[model samples]
Target: MPESFHKPVRRPSSMFDTIFGGHDPADTARVAHSTAHALLSRVREDPEAEVVERLVAFTAEHGIDTIASLWSQAPARSLPGALWRIYLLQLMVHEDANTSSIIYERGRHELASADPIVAGAPTPAGPDEMVALADAILRGVFDGDFAVALNRAASFSRVEASGATHLADDYELTEPERSTALTTKALRLSTFAADLDAAAAHWRAGTLT
Candidate 1:
């Protein structure tokens, strides 16, 4: 196991308790801690090949919804929690990829071309395509630099946000409030990209939370 994963870590209460009150946070934490450690250790052995293989196999065998159930309630600072966040971001994009593609197509024309580290791969055109790209990017976290994957996601977010802005204003009956909301979304995603940069640095330093 990575030294960081092995160190003492705080266990936080489940965020989903209010909605899903039956599950016990303590039991959930215990399972998550072990599962996260095992998976992290496996990835460490051969990050490039093993990480993707293990994740793919695990999900294929056990199902993503099963994993996501636990992930939804995991504490944010824990390893499982971080993994959950990463997975959730990808899932959101993938689940609605077609809609996202349409929006991306509309705004991408006005924006500067994405940087290689940002959106190096081809823009996804549908749910299946986006899921493939999302998987690749997530796989890249262990196969390559985690920061680059995060930056790419951030870039993806920015592009979508820009599209939303355009969509909000495309009509003759443009809604200033809606446009402003989209602008806010763009700014927030930009900050998330920066945070991902810091997270990458932390990961390198063995201090990621």
Candidate 2:
């Protein structure tokens, strides 16, 4: 585990804070959406590689809870929601690159689709490759193409989910608990794939926000 993962970071209060008249739900949503768009807009217009890299490493240095506080509540098909998912995916890979690489390799071998190609991961996707892939996908969101990045993420998720499912099956007999956990992970990854795909479509249609 990374030292950052062990650090205590404060999570902002949720919309539920509205119950205590702390934050108005409408205001919170407005701020979240505006901030998400502003950040993306700024980086895209800057055309600085360093700027993009800084944004890519923002969560790692400051903690994902910072951005999650802003976008976590957004709709899964919206821009803020898509950004949140990408950051979350990056954080996961960074926190457990070895495990991520193992499952990704399994997925690359088991999946017969073009997803591995679409994901753009290097062959044999070791831990370093997995980390690099995560960063590249995120960099695409800010510097390259947003919809394309989402598609890549969706494909990656599908491959990983497929791998997890197959691995779960292999462990079913002797490691029931591990199998069950992998099964759950597969289901969650599948859901992420679906959501990201939908988000890509929404982005293309100019309705992601």
Candidate 3:
């Protein structure tokens, strides 16, 4: 498991519960939490609807507010929570980076390791594609294409295990260095999201407010 999602042995409630698990009841980040909970619940409650239906509902009903709200109310100093915030925020902006074809292949391998969802689920873009997409989105921010940042990251074509894929061909990694690539890819995406979040917060605080 990623350290960002560790299970502490000495907490009354899990970090998720304290930070973002159960619904907040106060209507602050409550719906955001509830939607997240419902996402999980639907996975177990009605796994069938958990796929496309739930995603549609989430995008339609709450939009990025539901996502950003989670970040806004996220525990200020929680590293794991911060990582989650970054991941969620990135998930929003990079929605287009669909790497389903590649993921279907890699996910089969990752399922036996860890993070079945991350490994099992599809990515719109592979590592390089995602990073390029992130750069484009960041550039959009500079260009004042406010909505561009909210667009899905980018789509990535399938990569072959024989090492013909973009990342495999462009970046060489030793056998022990494989995980490093995945981690690096995920972090780059997260950093782009965090940067966008920072800029938005700055604008809201400095001017909008």
TM-scores of the models, in the given order?
0.61, 0.88, 0.28
Tens-digit lDDT track of model 1 for 1-209: 00122233322232112222227788877777687767766675677675576663444344345566565566554556556656655544544567656666665665676632365436544556555666776776666676566666656656666676677676426677766655565565455445555556666777764
The top-ranked prediction according to TM-score is 2
lDDT of 2 at 185: 84
- The list of candidate 1 runs beyond 4 A from truth reads 1-34, 47-54, 57-64, 74-78, 110-117, 123-129, 171-195
Which parts of model 3 have CA positions greater than 4 angstroms off?
Answer: 1-56, 70-73, 76-94, 100-104, 107-184, 188-209
Clashing pairs in 2: none
1 versus 2: better TM-score goes to: 2
Please provide, for model 3 over 1-209, each residue's C-alpha lDDT reduced to its tens digit, 9 standing for 90 to 100. Answer: 00121222222121112333435535644554455444434454544533534442343344444454454454432222232333443333234334423543453343343232321223443544543443343333223333333222211111122112334434455443654454454444434434434544544454311
lDDT of 3 at 53: 42
What does candidate 2's lDDT look like per residue over 1-209, in tens digits? 33344455543332112112215678767877899899988888875999999888887778766686687777777888788878877877887788888999999999999999999999888888998999999999999988999999999888889988999999999999999989988887888889999999988998878
Clashes of 3: 13
TM-score-based ranking = 2, 1, 3
Q: State in Å the error of residue 105, model 3.
A: 3.1
The TM-score of candidate 1 is 0.61
> For model 2, what is the alpha-carbon lDDT of residue 56?
88
Sliding window of 10 residues with minimal summed lDDT for model 3: 154-163
